[model samples]
Target: MTVLLTGLPSAGKTSLATAARAALLAAGHRVEVLDGDVVRRELWPELGLSPEDRERNLTRIGSVALLLARNGIITIVAAIAPYAHSRAALRAAHAGVPFAEVHVATPVEVCRRRDVKGLYARQARGEITGLTGVDAVYEEPLTPDLRIDTTLEDVGESAARLVDFILHGPVLSSPHGGRECSGRF
Candidate 1:
């Protein structure tokens, strides 16, 4: 299964992914988190934040998630994925696979306040531009499997909801087995 968590920066996508990964692992389920910042920094340092580049980044991440998911790993993806078309493309690519789109619907104002990485501060200082949900664009999901606002729900509660969805949600059985896949994370 691949769970794609999308939202503005500092909207708690990574926190939710980490909390859910811990619980899922505690339940003896194989899980992996593909965080967008880490992936971009480590794998695609040359990529800029242009729309095309962002789409390309998302495509690459989706490919990796699909590869791991096909092998029975529950892959949790935390990415801004600002473009609706890009996210839709990923979903289309995952046809017949267990895929869930989670929208971290935390408002941009709240995210700016959280600003875990000082992105908002940098933008405010004119050190950066085109920040998603600010100067750039973040096309909200038309219909997502789940929608969460971090300001309303804490990490533990959000993670519980995600874990429940993974375990009990309607997911197509993999070739490897049923809900309990038999492979790596």
Candidate 2:
């Protein structure tokens, strides 16, 4: 299974993904977390967050995700993935795999409040450029497999819902219950 956790910066995407990854591992599942920030810097240093650059990065990540998913490893990808086209391309690339797209639907205000890195503050002060959900774009997924609002749910419960969905399929009472995934591993 390849789970793509997408949202704006500080949207709890990494926190939620980390929690879910832990639960999956404790449940005897092979799991790994591919954080976009860390992976890009170490693995794809030449790549960037520009539209074309992002698509290229996402493609590389998607390939890795497909490879792991086929080998029965649950790959958790926590990325802003701010472009809809990039996400669509990833999904299309892994057509047959157990792909779960989870949107950490925390609003920008909430994310700003939780910005431990001061990214929002930097952006506000004109110290940074191309910040997603700010100067740059962050296209939300139209029909994500799961939508979790961190503002309304704690990290543990959010992770539990994700675990339940992956293990037993989408539960009726999802965190936000906006849309249901067709199937999952």
Please report the candidate that would top lDDT against the real structure. Answer: 1
- 57-168 per-residue lDDT for model 2 (tens digits): 7788888888998898989899889898788778777766778778888788887888868999998898999988978889988778787777765888888887887787
Model 1 clashes, total count: 0
TM-score per prediction, in order, is 0.91, 0.90
* Clash pairs, model 2 backbone: none
lDDT value for candidate 1?
A: 0.84
Candidate 2: list runs displaced more than 4 Å.
Answer: 170-185
| Per-residue lDDT of 34 in model 1 | 100
Least accurate stretch of 10 residues (summed lDDT) in model 1? 176-185
**Candidate 2 TM-score, true structure as reference:** 0.90
**Candidate 1 Cα misplacement greater than 4 A, ranges:** 172-185
